[model samples]
Target: MEVTDVNNVKIYNLSCGKTFPDWLPDRKKRQLLKKEPSLKRRIELIQDFEMPQLCNTINLSSNGEYIFACGVYKPTMRCYDLNNLSMKFERCFDSEIIKCKPLSDDYTKLVFMFCDRYVEFHSQSGRYYRLRIPKFGRDLDYHPPNCDLFFVGDTSDIIRLNLEKGQFLNPYQGSSTSFNCCKVNPFHHLLVCGSTDGQVEAWDPRIRERVGSLDCALSALTVDPQGIPAIRSIAFKDGVNLAVGTETGLVLLYDLRANKPYYTKDHMYGLPIKSVVFHQEWVISMDSKVVKIWDRETGKPFTSVQSQYDLNDLCLVPETGMFFLACENQKIQSFFIPSMGPAPKWCSFLDSIVEELEEDQDDAIYDDYKFVTTKDLEEIGLNHLIGTNLLRSYMHGFFIDHRLYNKAKATSNPFAYERYKKKKIAEAMEAASGDRVKLQPKLPKVNQELAKKLYDLELSGDGSRKAKQTVALLKDERFKSLFENEDFQIEQDD
Candidate 1:
């Protein structure tokens, strides 16, 4: 017994799912109900900016206004404007940036840890100051309460930089265990450091010494005869429970009260666990090979994705499903797991964008012309029209008119109709540009006196009302005329 769909008079497997029917009058209504917002949107949020090569680290500011990313290939740091969905600015450094962190809420104050055993402080405009560290820094975490920065590196000690005093403080020395990463628990005075010797150390910043350590790889299901797996990442769940990711791709959940791990989960791939995040109800771990999410308590597998890119780092907008991954070969990519949490207050439109994506059938955007590869050209029976102006040659393919696909195929001449096709393409471009375009170049409408007044007012940071009044007076219709008005006098130069 077959049942009909909600759509009326179903043609039984019509092309409506792939393309809007030509005879259909209400295409949007058919798609409206199917596009209801759900908690399963996991598509990449495309941002408008140029991406850097080998993005090694990423960080979100305390406020959701900006996102920062660093790439080692060119030793450059890129900041994205989340509010406008565009790039704010990019800065180049002398050495490869191991990690980038924001110290200020709005991303105005930032610190870039470089591989050259030095850290540079960058303000909103440019470099403010720099300090040389003892060892090469791997990662860093900022403690906002005390205005301190905890840095982990190739050494056993956790170096501290007193941001307020602008000097290096006493180091948090631990056993001869090289540290990989450090994270400060927001709910407590505890700071956790993941070591290269498969140990996660707990330190009390007030006492400035080691408190406790959890061995993540001890008594494991499958013991590696070579050596113990290194602890690569650590995330504090609360004041007690902690999440630790290891080099062997295992995530160990620990109860700070006990020595043994409460729950140990594996990613099964022997890759180094680069990041571990504790989202609502689930524990997310990324090991470059894949990203796995599992239940927090029972360790039941929720979902896993094979992100084959060279994932070097991961950053999450805490409390939300939104997280970003940094790759070595590709640009930083962001994913929103709608089921975990709703989009933040600043980016509420993400819900509608995801819903709209559901109604879109084709991956390519609708435009005046569409890119067609060799196979597409063959399928459309226009392979012989390759060299003609009707098919504009681009990278590895040609762009053909989307509306006149049939007409483009009818133009079988590879050479004879070149001049005619060129004229038609030019005409189409002119029509798209419209009549507002002028034939001659024109200058911007800027009055010299108004611009001078505004500039002086900005530099002085005074008299807002005076600047506005000056602009209003300069923009008067009488003064703007070619002939000077009697009310405005111009001094004659000798």
Candidate 2:
């Protein structure tokens, strides 16, 4: 199916089964008048949101319920509630905001970076902390599970900060030029940074050392021999593949195991890529001219939408397959893309029922006994084997089936009796076949004196007749024959 935009509406070219009937009214008919479910097309407007200031960066909460945006010109940070489609709060900053990110999963705290080398931290309760750093950070990323720590990339270095202690840690230095972007791979626990020298470097934060690096310049064409294209944006797929965007309007896909980019594409818009987002099967890249979605496997453009204003950032809501773009015109636009595979069944009806029941719970009697599904157990953090079994027994009045109890008891032994039993059986089989060895083979010991002489001669670089005679004495026929005779006698006894 092809989805296109016409007069601010999305026109979907859908296929119905049968053709239209002759009696259909032309004025009342849709774009495709079909009587027997033939091919048809229709227009739809899914969703949209407005912004009060031009947003340079946008971040969505884990639950996809709140949006945090900050930008320059107005230098304001604002939060929007997706459910109500309204602004929650707006806070103005002194310097132009370069980036805004939530400090935690619950969104209780937030971090903002300003163009004037100031980093600000704010909480939901209106408490805030501002720190002046050595240089302006171009990009920032929080530690996956630790809200107290974050990494910021600046010109020539990446710095780590501890918010809880209000202290700066040792800076990770490697980039020869300014860093344009940085990201943390939660799955692999890697810190990645993109530099103006057209290099992407991955660091092992635990060791405080550089682990992997890639030169993005090789992926793009160069006109000036000395000029290096700046890496503008970066995104990762499953912690194994990295997508890098450069100032030369080229997107390079690099496999973490390979030293070079596996795929490269010169963007059709030919503008610097402001942001890149990796969907399940598509790579969504946006810049000043347009937002383009490319087939991830083929590295070909699947679809693109032209924008009148420059796009600053793009975010994807994985749960709904919806994408949001923060633009230069003080607007946030959203679009829905159909999944490449069969869509999963949504539980909206069940969710609505639960919400309704939750609202009137006070009127209902609290039942001591309740039927619990697997999902309920998971929600309450009882999905493990022991927890699940305990919950099952409790819900069933502490009575478990005899067979299941026995199975669980057998499997729960810490010594792993099952493996022990298999090992014993294998040993017995070997004995029955008379294939077991009565004695273990011994490894030959090194000749220390001869080895020392050879080492000394090699280091001395002496190739004289005296050194040759000494080497021949070390390989004396009588001594070699004595060792060989012992080995032959041992093999004969076996």
Candidate 3:
């Protein structure tokens, strides 16, 4: 997918036809519909509120059933009930509501912080309480499975609050960098916090001291499966890993036990990630109107949302598999995650090859290759190489070059490569033992019809002359004759 700016608005250009699986019988859906009418794609405008005040920060409740938004000029917090998309305007003494969370069983009760210095709790029973502490707070996380408490932190210290008793415990002391994010381990008493100065500090609230520390922060923080701060925004099959969003719009996931990140993607957006969240399966982040949801395991974004304003906060409500998005424009939107059905059954042969390629690439400095499926190669006239021993040699050479080689991974259910493997071994043994090494045969040359069609593209009196340069890239070398006229001209039935 590519984003291009025309005039002042950004237009998303999707290259849906450019895919690796070109061989399946019914796979070329987009290409088959070439002459069909174009479809207009528009973002769903769920709801909008014109708040001239303009908000800079937003937060959602733990369960994602309520929205809390605040801006610089606004003196009070705005609360929106998600039960029926209703809203209530409430006044507050706090200068700014920077963070908020649900404190009790009833969704009506809430706890929000003002200027990171004061914590205010408004109970459903019409009672309110405020607590002032020495350090400021950045993020609030409520812990459930282990302790009946919540955690918040500033630059140098973290505060643990017992919500049931409405009390604050001794502050957990740590580094001096301001904390940018924090999360509680639901299965343990550990509290993890990431600092603006690139430090991750982990502490057990019961011990009231620091237990572990790592470097790198300013993105999202989460505990891994071992209940360690090894990963960030994404979850893995064995453990939770950290998905670090840098200022350059690159997303990376680091395993806690490893010193380096496992995967990295330059998402190419120019906005800083304000908040990142992960469900059991996906990682979600904010980037203007497009809320990108990436598969935690694959590091690929499968879906996104298009909007007019930047998304400041996002949360996944696991009970319903629905997502709540709180925009900087003070409007909250919720959408159901399209059911992806079940995990598609994969051919073990292809799956193994793909995994091997990924691992080899990660461990070595090989070039990246764009591989096409057997069907695609066949259409381009390269199919005979599939089962030849020469092909295995070619794959070995490809591995030596460290390029991607998952061509047959998604095809033919069982991905039967045994036939091809035997052929390749025979050819390789014959060649390796000093017999003549026959180079792979080339495909039939490009036809005159296709060349003329390409040439017409050059002189069609349209703005496609630039396209002609790429037509030269057609795989069939024999097609070049169509360009005989060098400077072809149009003739009106002459």
Candidate 4:
């Protein structure tokens, strides 16, 4: 549905199901219950300074206060302030910092990993040391036990490393598989690892042997909220439940203790479930490109948002309710969980559709047209349908009062008349606007940015004044030199 923002009038395109569901009350009743949040919150673009020589991957600190962005090129590490959205500091590393995690107690100590499977221990003060592992490292996590070691998961094996000793030990060598993710158990000596083969296996680093194993089968697995490894990446909240994100973007929260899943919510599309986290109140998942949050206890889907890019790494910052979305492009996007006070406007729309469908006793007649609505045409908007002249038949249809097979003869260019109508309307509007707009002396365009800026300023309330100022400014030899620059030129053909 196309929802217009009364503030700015910019409309957003949304799917029908998104704004309307099959279980809600009538539209009037739904509208009375809640109002749509206005489109006042446009995306504010932050200027990126201290540009990396080459961008790779990005991660945020556990507290969401700092961002650690790394690039494949030299000068690998760059740190930015999450609050102000600006680069606060930067450091050049020997190689790209593929991943970084800060110790809970000491913010100075950071575990940095590189693409070459090399890891380094560095202090915020610039002192650093490296740990060497034979197998290439794919992902790693710190083992919180008193053993003072970090567990590193690679494509084929799991390894244990003592950061202080720079020593490494492989707990699982031959069982090596395409490992994807891993976590250290809270109360046990077992380290859980997930693989592409859909297996979640536990290994006792002390004995260097496998203890428990479960087939997650393309399921992003995590130890359940109850601290058990029943499935991969699926977790529990109240001691008997399980929450899992599947490869098909179906997030399931089950009550294993009850031998049943509490509920399941399919993401709008099929996206490879990348990660899942069970907070005390929410079951969150990173699937394909969206961050999905659901109710932990009820298993009801709450809300979802695309993280602005393909998310490769993700984690939630405890206590603050903030989350970090890390992209392979070396940019980390941090977002805060908005309070669950008023639901989105689309929620109300869905509720209305559902209620109407239930109230209709003769639902079969309208079953095929259930998806149809006036909002559909408005949502597609004039811009997208402008160039494509098929809107008449595709976006609308003519009704016939005749019986049986009475029909309008199909025309090759059914929307041709509609296209002409719209074109004439646009030309009339353009001509009306041209009456007051005075043409300016064209200058060679120096750059797109400058051209756009000048256009915008001239289009502002004081176009004549701005035009005169531009003409005077262009008379300067320095300004004329800009036109001669290799970057600037306006085609005379126009």
The candidate scoring highest on lDDT is 1
Error at 127, model 4, angstroms: 4.9
Give the per-residue lDDT of model 4 (tens digit) for 237-339: 4344445555556666654334334566666566656677776677778764777777776756666656445666565655444455655443345444424
The C-alpha lDDT values of all candidates are 0.72, 0.66, 0.52, 0.53
Q: Flag the better candidate by lDDT, 3 or 4.
A: 4
Off by over 4 Å in 4: 1-65, 71-75, 81-86, 104-106, 147-156, 173-176, 186-190, 204-209, 218-268, 328-332, 340-494
Q: Model 2 — which ten-residue stretch has the worst lDDT?
A: 341-350
RMSD (CA, Å), candidate 1 to true, equals: 26.2
Q: How many collisions between residues are there in candidate 4?
A: 21
lDDT of 3 by residue, 1-494 (tens): 23333323222322211222336456455554463333222222222321325564555565555656555455556665655455555545536767667665545777777774877778765438777756676667776643444444545666667666656666667674456677665555466676655566777766566877655432323221211122222222233466655443556666767656676655556455655666667676665556676787787666666666666666555444355555655334445432322111211132343345447655444235443455555553546666654333334231211121343433532434664665577667756876666454333243445555655554333333467565554545674443444344334467
**Candidate 1 lDDT, 383-437, residue by residue in tens:** 8888998888889988888876756555644553665666577668768877675
- Candidate 2 per-residue lDDT over residues 412-461, each given as its tens digit: 55456655776677667767967655453332344444445565564344
TM-score of each: 0.62, 0.59, 0.50, 0.50
Candidates ranked, most accurate by TM-score first: 1, 2, 4, 3
Best by TM-score: 1
Q: Which is the winner by lDDT between candidate 2 and candidate 4?
A: 2
